[model samples]
Target: MNRLDIIQALMGQKNLKNYLEIGVENGHIFFRIKSTFKIAVDPKFIFDATRRFGKSIINPYNLNNQYFEKTSDDFFAQDAQRVFSAKKLQLALIDGMHEYQFALRDVENVLDYMDDNGVIIMHDCNPQTAGAAGCFNDWEVGEWNGDVWRTIIHLRSQRPDLNVFVLDFDQGLGIITKNKPESTLLFSPEQIKELTYNELVQNREQWLNLKSADYFYNYFDLQRP
Candidate 1:
């Protein structure tokens, strides 16, 4: 399944109201979401802003579309409370920096502000090629997954109590929930940083929790009250 499919499936199962998306490149996924109160955070949003989603969906607080043209860190530091405004953050998508620490921090930040039943979707957890899963900031544009997968490994290792799994589709979409927030960091960010694409390839069996897309739906269904 693609990212849209996964999101659509989850949307079907949950009544999402407030949504936050980081890294809205062209508003492909950003505008598609029908959440009542929506926040899109991107350092640079490259979509045609005039274009509309063609739906008159109402939000909890009647707020209009909120877009922050800043990094996720800055967006959270300055506007997180304003964005949620005492309303629980129900859904958040982290498709930001694509780096391990950045992704990890994004997850952490979302968890800190999320509702008890909130869900976080992280993109690029499964890289199909070394070219796409590189550790370097400078990568050849062909399908770069960056080091986001490391964030999954780090989360699994550090927060085993959290409900986390990686969908084996759309280059590895990760679902994280079951709030067990903590102040722990990976023992050594450098150790995870030092890992190369080759090392990841060699250690994939040990680091990734690869799961079928159906598994996610089934798991979510079971979690439903």
Candidate 2:
């Protein structure tokens, strides 16, 4: 499915109120949600006016959204729990730091703030297709490896009670619901192990070649400018 379809599904969900987005390169998706309050987190300091397309002048008028310029990990570690307590998040989208560990942390942080019935939409699960091209159609600014997939695989094993659906199309979106899901759809430990193993084998070469170690070593050296 496309972004529009994702938005429609979110809109159709019952009792949705506040929304949170981990990576807001611009306010494109933020503006689409029409929520009373939107909290967008990104480390990038410069908000590209071009993201507003040719309608740049009209964009600043949108004041319902608030932007927090900080790395996703830092933002969550410092303030996520507090924010969640203040506003029970109805919807959350995680599109930041697509490394396996980072993605896993992002999910954990979002869940900390999400209401029991709330749903989360994870982006960039299809690394071979749409995400490979480095742009996620009209909704994203750049691409990263499908680390969220690895996280999902881990969560499937670690949290058997959570509802996880790997949507088949549009860059392989993953929908996770906190609501008590039907037991029939849940995955077994063996199945989770198999899936995770397969993914590791399939991406072993790329995984080994990743600059994750160096990235983290000099992480603070790199600032969003």
Worst-scoring 10-residue span by lDDT in model 1: 53-62
TM-score of every prediction relative to native: 0.85, 0.68
lDDT of 1 by residue, 24-75 (tens): 8887887777666788899988865345333223222323678899999998
**Each candidate: how many clashes?**
2, 0
Tens digits of lDDT, candidate 2, 56-109:
345543456666789988887787777666788888888776655676788887
Q: What lDDT is obtained when candidate 2 is compared to the true structure?
A: 0.60
